[model samples]
Target: MFDGFTPEHLALLRGAGVPAAWPRGGVLMRQGEPADRAVLIETGVVKIVSESANGYVSLLALRGVHDLIGEFGCLDDTVRSASVVAMRPVHGFVIAAPRFCALMEENGPLALAILRSVINRLRHADDQRAALGSSTAVVRVAQVLLELSERHGTPAPRWAPKARHLKLTQQELASAAGTSRESVVRTLRELHQRELVETARGAIVVLDPEGLEWWEPEGD
Candidate 1:
């Protein structure tokens, strides 16, 4: 909900508690559904997926805690541009297409909110771009650590890269950093030795982001 919704809009959504749910691996939506409105996460996680030519599920993004699913679809009706699947048990608020349109029409400020959000995200992507452009694996890893420091460290977008939507597997990291899994593993092992990062609960936790960034390998 916006800071204020018109009374008419409020009345319309009185009973419209999207009340949606998804289990892990549940398909929230397919790739070709009629694109209308977007979904808001009330709880749990959602994954925006991309598929391979042979039809394997590839994780494109992961959204958690108040993230919007398919907002682009809501703005303009078209074929669904991507697939959304539940990464964990999820519940959301589904803003229907017409209602969403009404919101934009009634609230000029809402439009501004959208634009600001997009700009902020763009800045984060630019940071990640700089991170990848780094000349060495240490730098790349440090950049990722910086990102995580912002995520799990300071937990703020301005202080960290905004990639809450990214669900990076080792394969995805390989694709992002242009390296093999073995290389990633080797680097990770080195980082582990220095206690700069630790693997836990299916994700990497940055221990000493400063130390990780400061310690450059002999060649790198």
Candidate 2:
């Protein structure tokens, strides 16, 4: 979905006649690869992630329809700075970078909205970095839960989901949160004993949101 798509913008997309479907996984785009094209989603989700020299991966963004990826590299005349992978099957409308720039130049209103969306995402990433680096693991996990809740949370007017749709394993969670599985498991157990979380077969659910955030221990 568009973070800032308007009815007028939808009209513009239709008028421009962008394609209705584009899909790829695995190596959707590679680091240092030329920015040959930019894509806008029409369906499904894609992840923008970067691999470090040590082979650690950091998730950058999750994009749905109307969220543009690789546009920055294309605009800056540089190679792609990161890789994009399809989390699931994706359908997108793709255009060469030069053409997208030309279209944006001609279509001022839609261009402005897209630019704003990109800027907002960068700002959010910066804030997330700050929070994760300075906060405790409990705080970090709490934030992740809130994020998953927003994107994959149920829509039944419930306080939160009984289970999250995070497609990450415990090791992955530990890496992202800068902690260990034992510690994470311990924290989960502590929360569980207090009836603040419920464990399913492979997933965990947050019961008392504030309690999870309040779980910071000494020297943690």
In order, candidate lDDTs are 0.61, 0.65
- Report model 1's TM-score to 2 decimal places: 0.70
* lDDT per residue as tens, model 2, 139-194: 67656655754464333324354434444445545555667677667766766677
Model 1 ranges off by over 4 Å: 1-17, 54-59, 145-168, 176-178, 213-215
Model 1 lDDT per residue over 1-220, tens place: 2233344433443334366778877887788888876776667766676766787555455566655566577777887867888756788777787777676677676556655555666676687777677657646655664554443232223323432222345554444455666776777788779766655444555566667657776564
Error of 1 at 41 (Å): 1.8
Q: How many collisions between residues are there in candidate 2?
A: 1
TM-score for each candidate, following the candidate numbering: 0.70, 0.75
Clashing pairs in 1: 62-165
